[model samples]
Target: MTANTHDRGAPAAPARRSGLGVALFLEATERFSFYGMLSILLVYLLDVRGLAAPRANLFVGSFNALALVSTLLGSRLGGVVLGPARTVLYGCAIQFMALVLLGLSVMWPVLFLPAAAAVAVTNGLTRTNMAVLILRHAGGGRSADGLATLYTFAVNLGAMFSFLLVPWIGRRHGYALAFGACAAGLFMGAAAALLNRRALAGGASGGTARAVPRAVAETGLAIVSYWVVLNFPAGGHWIFWLVTSAIPVFWAWAWRNATPAERPGIAICLILVAEAMFYGMFDEQTTSTFVLYALHDLNRQFSVAGVTLFELDAPQIVAINAGLTMLLGPVFVVLYRLVDARFGTVALSVKYVCGSVFIVIGFLVLCLDTAGGAPGLRAPWGMFGAYAALSVAGLIMNGLGLSVVTTYLPARMRTMSVAVYYISTGLAMYGGSVLANAMGIGRLHAATPIPESLSTFHALFRGFTLLAACGAGGIVLLLPVLRRLERRAG
Candidate 1:
């Protein structure tokens, strides 16, 4: 079948478009709720729960990593047992309950870890399946690229609102209110999914009985591994290493199983996932290290005529990145279409390389800010530049990464490939956590002088800039191979 042809069991064009709209709504809501909670989680843990910076960073990082890694199990269950549509509904219901528990944890305190775990696990089921729904609704065609861009726009739009609103609510009312708002968003998503059930029909059927036992076993192992790493932060890097090391083995298995025509596409997918790990490492700092920096160093107050109007909270500062992404997304989408119209489809490798360079530039901007001898009141323009660059990098890297999975992989592999892509990010988040800790920013207390921490932050930024530069150079070296693979796949 051609790329433009509808999948075997897809609905008619009009129905499919309707389904796509519903899926996008669900995606936006889910992201809004999930990211809203995350944007405030570090502060909640530190201020409300009375945890130190190191521990709070670990908790946030582990939560993100576990949520992503568990997608392996979610993919198996969604693709083989429950089907994507059913899995999405179930995930929404579970996520709602998890958010409620998180709200309650503000009072009880003991419920915090378990509530976080619930949110993480349920995320595995929802994130990948929602993307699968979008792909199915797109009829798995060339339009998938445009739809993927729209999908990313929806994600950032929801995140932008949540990042701005949730943090404001948390700052004014309480963290519990923020959590409650997230739960409300999830409830809306669930309602939409239920109301549009017929339009979202026809996903994978339950697999053979023999496959069930192994799926259950793999899920059990994945959960146990996450538990151990979460409990033992010192050894978490090893766990992430173990998880990431399996990528090659999984790729080899997929390549061997695939037909000759499919191998090139599979190869491209693997390369993109690997490249994305570096991007994820840098990008995730917005929620962790960057938030801390803004809280301690950035001058977030707005003043006119020597009168302060409002001051931005740390989490709200993080929202600037999402807000910028929302603003920039449409411009990039139009630019990509124009390029594709004049020239044929752009190679995924080229986009990946461009994103890497942007990441390097973003981190360099941060590095320069750190070196500028600003004590506790660094200028916000440096952060603005960094956020803008990172937003563009994400629009290119993450947006196109999802498009590659949906466009190239077969139906049977699509969900699993999506899951693997997420796993790469999981590893990156964990890696970023380690890097954050090494910078010693976690050791800074409320009374600690900002100048004392400047060198450490500067060093960290310079290291990341170097790392991203090396990654971009490596991709450039492999461009010949990547282009060959694209041609073979075509």
Candidate 2:
């Protein structure tokens, strides 16, 4: 569908919170479908389609970048044509269609890249639109925490469901059936969003949906810059988890005291850059690199309801990480709240640093699993540790950072700001994948003489650790610039 061409109209003021439960429910389900498919895409390409692992990785990376770019287009379309509710509906419809196409790709096997791209765009749009809705309804410290919890809960629940469901389906039936099930879930989510139309679009308030070309252009430029800078560190970090994406988060926090004129753009840039690094690291660990590790090195198993169904493969094992997060997001939220109370204001910098520490520890354990001769060295349970880190980081960044960034921006620029942050991550995700593939060329692939030991993987980890440390340092250095910008805006 093309961008909406409806007359610009004022948004309806939010009067009720009726369908929030349903909305959150649908969001969770959709997230499950998206990530479930994502966790398995590289395997699908390599195992099912006969594509080389490196090529498959690049395809997935390209898809991620495109999807991130689509969010900008989706937000613009939402503003001009369908308004907020309709925009969300459009994204849902796209998601449904994408899922169906993905199922077909599994069945026919030629539609992989196209199907993947469609799904990516759907996810990007849905995330941005849903976020806009939540931001419109809430603000302030606790409110931000609440919204982040709700958002994280929904996503983690979806991830949790996918981890269990996809493994069972793919193991018992096949890839095609597994993808088809995901498509059905997507349709269900779309249906739920359609039922709650009013609440979704109520954020339009009284302000008409005027296309502010200058504002859009300015926001777009800032996003492009943020993405370019953000992706370099993110790409390096994603290949290995030695480093943390915490610096970007701290940089965003540093903007709290900046001038209004500049705060939104600068904050958005830093948040997106940081988040891009965070997600790049998280996704690569669970999806691409980790999946390969499990298949090649680990003893895979499928234990369902206390019964061991079969030895699950690498792609399926990745679901464990998603599942754990789905189960733990709410618990983390409660913990965050308690911690925030003790820490007083609980600045973004604090959360960023804490989250990065989790990542560092997770990787440290993984390093031990690889180098310390841990049991299951071939089929390490280190992934469970990786998931734990992802959950903690998600709570801090998605829960805490988003709230700060959204509240810190002016209303007129909020959506654009969110979009900017999103696109930055998109670039980081794609770039990181590309770099990983390149790094693996003569290093980790099937052809390379199996490294004599775990030394190769250790080297990868050390490289990433150095990158993360550098990015974190950059955050410190950039603090003055962010503060200066924010003060000027004020």
Candidates' C-alpha lDDT: 0.80, 0.59
Q: How close is every model to the real structure, measured as TM-score?
A: 0.92, 0.77
lDDT of 2 by residue, 1-490 (tens): 0001111342433343544565677777778788778766776777776766666666666556556656666666555544555556666676676677777776665565456656666665677777766645453233565666677778778877786677578767888778877878878877776776665556453224454444345334533543443334234334223112433443455466455565555653464356445645545545676666665555565345666666656666665666666567777667767876786444455456666656566666555566654433444446566667766666665555456555455455456556656666666666667656555522555543334325555555555556656655655555566555444534
Residues 419-470 of candidate 1 have per-residue lDDT tens digits of 9888888889878887878767567666657786676678778888888888
Q: Give the count of colliding residue pairs in each prediction.
A: 0, 19
Best by lDDT: 1
> What are the runs in model 2 whose C-alpha is more than 4 Å off?
1-16, 139-142, 203-282, 301-312, 339-343, 372-376, 398-401, 446-453, 473-490
**Residue-level lDDT for 431 in candidate 1:** 82
Worst 10 residues of 2 by lDDT: 1-10
Off by over 4 Å in 1: 1-8, 139-142, 202-229, 302-310
